[model samples]
Target chain A: MFNYIIVGSGFAGSVIAERIANVLNKKVLVIEKRSHIGGNCYDYRNKDGIIIHKYGPHLFHTNYKEVFDYLSNFTDWRIYYHKVLAFIDGKKVPIPFNFNSMDILFPEILSKKLQEKLLKKYPYGAKVPILKLKKENDKDLKFLADFVYEKIFKNYTIKQWGKRPEEIDSEVTARVPVCIGRDDRYFDDKYQALPEEGYTKIFERMLSHPNIKLMLNTDFKEIMKVDLKGKKIYFLGQEFKGKVIFTGMIDELFAYKFGMLPYRSLDLHLEVIEKEYFQEVAVVNYPNDYDFTRITEFKHIHPIKTNRTVILKEYPKDYDPERDIPYYPFFDKAAREVYAKYQELAERFDHLILVGRLAEYRYYDMDDVIKRSLEVFEERIR
Target chain B: MFNYIIVGSGFAGSVIAERIANVLNKKVLVIEKRSHIGGNCYDYRNKDGIIIHKYGPHLFHTNYKEVFDYLSNFTDWRIYYHKVLAFIDGKKVPIPFNFNSMDILFPEILSKKLQEKLLKKYPYGAKVPILKLKKENDKDLKFLADFVYEKIFKNYTIKQWGKRPEEIDSEVTARVPVCIGRDDRYFDDKYQALPEEGYTKIFERMLSHPNIKLMLNTDFKEIMKVDLKGKKIYFLGQEFKGKVIFTGMIDELFAYKFGMLPYRSLDLHLEVIEKEYFQEVAVVNYPNDYDFTRITEFKHIHPIKTNRTVILKEYPKDYDPERDIPYYPFFDKAAREVYAKYQELAERFDHLILVGRLAEYRYYDMDDVIKRSLEVFEERIR
Candidate 1:
């Protein structure tokens, strides 16, 4: 008998499991289909003894102090500020189209003029997305916006989402910004660093509580079949007294009553080389040129001193419900409508608390996932 | 009888083969120990359909028009200007420590001062090596030089050569330079490009001549025991009347009677990822961080539109006489003395012409090797 049964061992479920065991003194069973924990955040020591992320580069960054502080309890910090470069026109330039980038790409006169215009229009440290800048009436500003959109955003968006920049939702394009200042960092977060011992160590510490029972390589569907018994929850062919916390797909939980929700998955190619290091920075974005979105050198992320290095290349793929695990949820009108019906259906069970990126059918950063888990614990579990 | 017995099918042997078959209209036999042609320059489409350099990234760039024009007969050019970035202090700055790199790494005042000093000391397009720059008398220039040497050169040299920076030859450290200008390119050659169809295609076209017979998976040692018989060449239990061009290690040819000349070998790790592209550039160099020297993303070198990408990492290791294929000759005084003895022994046979990087015991760029082959043909073979 468990006090709560949590599906998935990703950040969402693990964070909830930690809180349930520590804060509420409850016995929690976390069911994960994958052999390993941490879901997309799973990292391990390779054969060459380099710590590598099995998935693409998961850069831990957030503006939320609470989320940062909570994670700090689990692992020490490496204080890594992530910076990215995009290969365009046979040159590696600073991404986010900052002032330094403008100087690198454009002519002296044109770059100066654009810089003056940008500084005049926006605050010194402001970050304006290409889509918002594209709506500008000024010709110079429009030109700058269009240049970034075409060179850096368009092809990447098509490859990443299988849709044109215009066809995709504005939020997708809005994530990539054009900075007015000379700060070349990819993210402007108050808390930006990698776990000193790697992300896996953090998850190891968080889920180490005695009350939290982790059952990996076991799917939620296999453990218990949920059914409605006159407005009472019955699971595993019995009246389940424990509360159910489903952190997997909401539509899958309800057996696709509103058809399948769309998602974008990634196929990652990881290689270990006999070299000490590879690449300039942690990640390099190939927006306009290559088929893959970006290449991440793991040594740059963790700075491990080894004779060998590991690198991962990310290829954007269409999620197959039967084959692929859901990664990024596609947020469109059709998806929203399908999710709304699922949300309404989920309301029938008071004991069932649907949460996390997959269950809610929304995209989330590491910090947001942690914050969401904390909020869910406070509102429902407590 | 063959007109020429060319040992090793790399640039050295292949160039001679092409020249002999086409220019002199002579029959030539090329013996390669490796299963494939092109020697170290051999690149092939792997299982994932991405072209990879079996050894490492080979960027073809040369100032000599004759060398470039001669090789141009074999394959079309991709017109690729190679640029490298160094991962130092958590920033992706251009290598060669150019004016732009100074701006990225140092404070505004210090960067401006150093820029002015560099411009004043060197020509607009001049590249001054770190060792040369370290000899500067000016306080500002010395600081700049020391900064680059410590950050970019020292650790990389230590890991690469297995020796301290001071212990390594000055010529070795003299190869990596500091640019006076804002040019972020690794090389400032007049002709800078890749073989449009990959390096293997060039070798394929070069060796496709009817007169050129390629015998792969065959070493010269296995086929023949070389001995001077009254100025007559004998091979494979038969009298061979042909010019023997040896491109393999000269010391190995003598059976290491004077003790084996030292050489460094590379262990390459290759991986095929399910991504379309990886990294912003073809090669990323890690100087201060990792044990491996660099990581090369193949798609950036040859842009083939595919859902997968290939990467190669190079790990430098001490050459084992029995196990490793000698890639780089150690230029230490003791090694040079041993090589001198081998050269003296090689000079005994009038028909035996020692050629290429390994045979000559010197590091030669792609163009230099081709140029040396032409010169050798004119002076000796012709």
Candidate 2:
């Protein structure tokens, strides 16, 4: 009998399963609906020996030392900063809209003026969100904010979320910021790198414990039943007393008791080009011109010895449960209210815990998800 | 008595000393003429609580995995890519002159034409030397090469080496390459970073072995003698049979017997400015503007919470044995001939081994020096 049942085999589920089996020395079963583990972070080698991310580019960056150290045990790292550029005014400029980007986009006089002002207002390395910049009363700052918004943020946000910048959560917009200095990296986290062997290896190593059993291509509904009225759960048609770590969609877990949550999906179009390189960096955003938000070249992230290069163009669209995969869980007021009811219902269960992006309906980064999982393991599971 | 006597506690000497003590379990004496260790790579926190590299900015970057793994024992590393920009034509552009620099310097149409020409000729990310680029038969490429050479390379080369590009060895000018891509890092080595604490700490930890003794403020000339005719080395006025790892200036060790191996020195002028940041990057080359070759802000390398910033301006000059530190050893045919003579003289001794930038008269990076030292230990000392 398993001491714990973890639904979903992403960082959240895999981490907890690994911890439960290794740290507690207890039997744990991990159920993954996907054919393989690593969930959305899965990457595999192509015919040309290029490691391509199946979903989109997942850059691992964080300021959390504990998170970095914890992940280090499973895999070695390749020092990669995850550079990104946004095509603006018929030229590609570094995104997160830095001083370098400003120099490329604006004239010398205006670039210098804007840079000086930004430095004066914020610290050298301060990352100012566009929304924060929009609140600026200063005329030049307002102009600068408007320029960045129109050139680099608006159309992309509209395409990705199917909503204006103001309609979506501010947290989502804050992901891409205006760096006061010239650092062109996507994130200025203290620890920024990629797993030497694609992220799947980290998952494989993490779940390699003798006490952990993985059920791939298996849905939780196949062997598990939750009796909400009786406040009891049954596993394999028997009464189960062990904890249930649910990392799947909260709405679907309770069979949409309240309502369905909203999410943004992506149509990932991949192309293998017969060239040395398609672009200078790993990712490039087309804010205004293209229907797709961004294009990612895998070779830039995982440098391989091949003349052929593979590129992924992401077309963000409204997610349908019947058709597409939920990539981003952006919340509205109604969705938040519904989530609150789900949380209240989840608390009613004695041994059930809700976690991960889908469960919480939060836009958590890779490190944030791991951090939460670690916290849950320490506070509840341990 | 120590089994090995090493002069200069830099990466070259310290690495060998540590290996001898730990790997071979042999007693090693490391003598550094300076009051401190780490040679030119020494760094410490100043009054403002900012780590400052005493001689100059020494950013450690290498493609050698073995060298990186070897050094990992002594210290952890922070992710740092040394970004250098040159002030050209009233604007700061990324150095090693790339597509980005070309865009900044040339008009839009000209920049496009030049970039297309470069791409057609070279693969993406290929680093081309200015000399090679200058010999281009293509009219557009030649024009572009001429412009880059005149604007960026020529003046900096003249200031740093005190010789025209045509006059100096082609090897010296090849160090600063023209990257075809938009990577703004001064060096694009696979591993680029700085020690987490400081370089001095690494040196301290490296020499912490009980078998390794460090002698500071002690010149080997004060106690050690080399008998050319006798082919003997003596330490503390006693005939010593231990291996002597000499990493000091080659000509000085032999009392300028082959005249003097030419070197370039720097006049480092440090200033503490009452501002948050003095520049956008850690280092900025002022090729055509000021007398000083470059300015480096220490805060960028080691970010700290101080309103006042510290910067170092380096003024290049001819090396004087009486004064100034020998920073760069750029050799002419005569200097190379002189170095060959010194190398032959040092090779005559039974146990004397010369390694490092100064001793070998080679422009070795930090990793190269460590690698050579490790090689020397394996081949000779071990």
Listed in order, the DockQ scores are 0.01, 0.01
Give the per-residue lDDT digits (tens) of candidate 2, residues B1-382.
5788899889999899889999999877777776567999998665455788999999999999999999898888899989999999999999889999988888999889988888998999999987789898989888877877888889988888787878978777777678898988888789998888879888878877767766554577865887767989877556888889999999988878879888899999999999989999999998878899999999899876667899999999998888889999968888889999999999888889998989998989899999999998899888
In model 2, how large is the Cα lDDT of residue A166?
A: 82
How would you encode candidate 1's per-residue C-alpha lDDT over A66-135 as one tens digit per residue?
A: 9999999998898889989888787778887799998899999999999999989999989998888999
Q: Candidate 2 on A167-229: residue-level lDDT in tens?
A: 977667777678999888787789999998789888878987767766554567765888878
Error (Å) of candidate 2 at residue A148 is 68
Provide the DockQ value for model 2: 0.01
Q: Which residue pairs clash in candidate 2? A: none
Candidate 2 ranges beyond 4 A from true positions: A1-382
